[model samples]
Target: MHRFANPTRFLRLAAAVLPFSAAVAALCLGAGLVWGLFFAPPDYQQGDTVRIMFIHVPSAMMAMGVYAGMAISSAIALIWRHAIADLIAKASAPIGATFTFICLLTGSLWGKPMWGTWWVWDARLTSMLIMLFIYLGYMALWQAFDDQTKAARAAAILALVGAINLPVIKFSVEWWNTLHQPASLITMEGPKIHESLLWPLLLMIVGFGAYYLTVLIFRVRAEIHQRRTRMLRMAQADRHNAMQAAD
Candidate 1:
């Protein structure tokens, strides 16, 4: 934690990990999509329409996972003042939001075929929508402040507060009757999905996680460089002002 706080050390670690993450993401996504789309058996009831689950399920899972990660990073930044943690949280928001958007879009697409409607106010669907709003709000909060430090603090608090929605999203199906299906992959008894479908879904989930890591490294690295550039310009301005005062 503290050891990796330094930008240089973090950058070195990211460089080492980036190639592996990228490779795994590419391999898993390619294999999973091919297996899920072409090889796996379709749902007996839904037929080809079931194929959308490969993308929708993984993106939905990743949306929550990424937000959980952001909240954890925000907590670290607030508690330990880990310099890299705030940047990680900032970098994760857009990616999480994109995943959330994909989940909602695909869910709507899948729903129209299965449920005879493109939209619903079901517990799971509504909570997932709220999660998307929270992600957007978190990103907006960061931009609300001119001072990065203040922005980070405000965003961190919002992230921590927004975390309450996560459980709601997760358990919404159980808490109420909903058109959405209950948990299949993570049931207490075990995954209810058959092996052929399950394997490809698992692969997609892993790929999504790896992809998030790959992109996070790039975004965080860019953020570090941008912050450094901003600091340098500010210092130069201060020095010029000092020189003027001396003259």
Candidate 2:
């Protein structure tokens, strides 16, 4: 991990991996959507409404998974002062937030038909909503500070604290009565769903993972360049100040 601390090395690695990740993401996501929507057998009860699960489930998984990544990165940055780790946490926040939003939106769309309402304060739903707010708060903290170091520290602390919510979101269905169903695919007994529907859902999840990695690499590279440009400007300013003082 420390080997990746060098921006140049990390950028080279990212460049090598980006094209493959982008291609796999596009192919898998397109194929998964097509398979799930048109070919997969629909739920006997929910019928076509079940098609929404392909998008909703993948987004929901990525939403929590990305936050978990941020929390781990935050821990690395705080403990080891890994520069790339801090940037990763920063880069992941907005993407995680986007997936969280998508999860909420699609969940609501799915709920209207099954639950007879577009919204509910069920434990699972409410906990997921809180997770979304936590992502927003983490991003907002970065913008609130002028000092990058201070901001990163503050954001890291918040991320570590916010990680407590992940488990709450995960187990909310079990801890309390909720309209949301319990885990079907990831149970101790293995997936309860039939193989026909499961394969496409798995493909969508994989595609989303690839998509996140591709975006993260691009964002981190951009952030490194931005930091370098800022440092260069600051160096020029210091040189001008020294010259004026000598004069």
lDDT of each: 0.85, 0.85
lDDT accuracy of residue 46 in candidate 2: 76
Residue lDDT tens for model 1, 204-238: 99999999999999999999998888887988999
lDDT of 1: 0.85
Q: What does the lDDT come to for candidate 2?
A: 0.85
Q: What does candidate 1 score on TM?
A: 0.89
Q: Which regions in candidate 1 have their CA more than 4 angstroms from the true location?
A: 1-5, 168-191
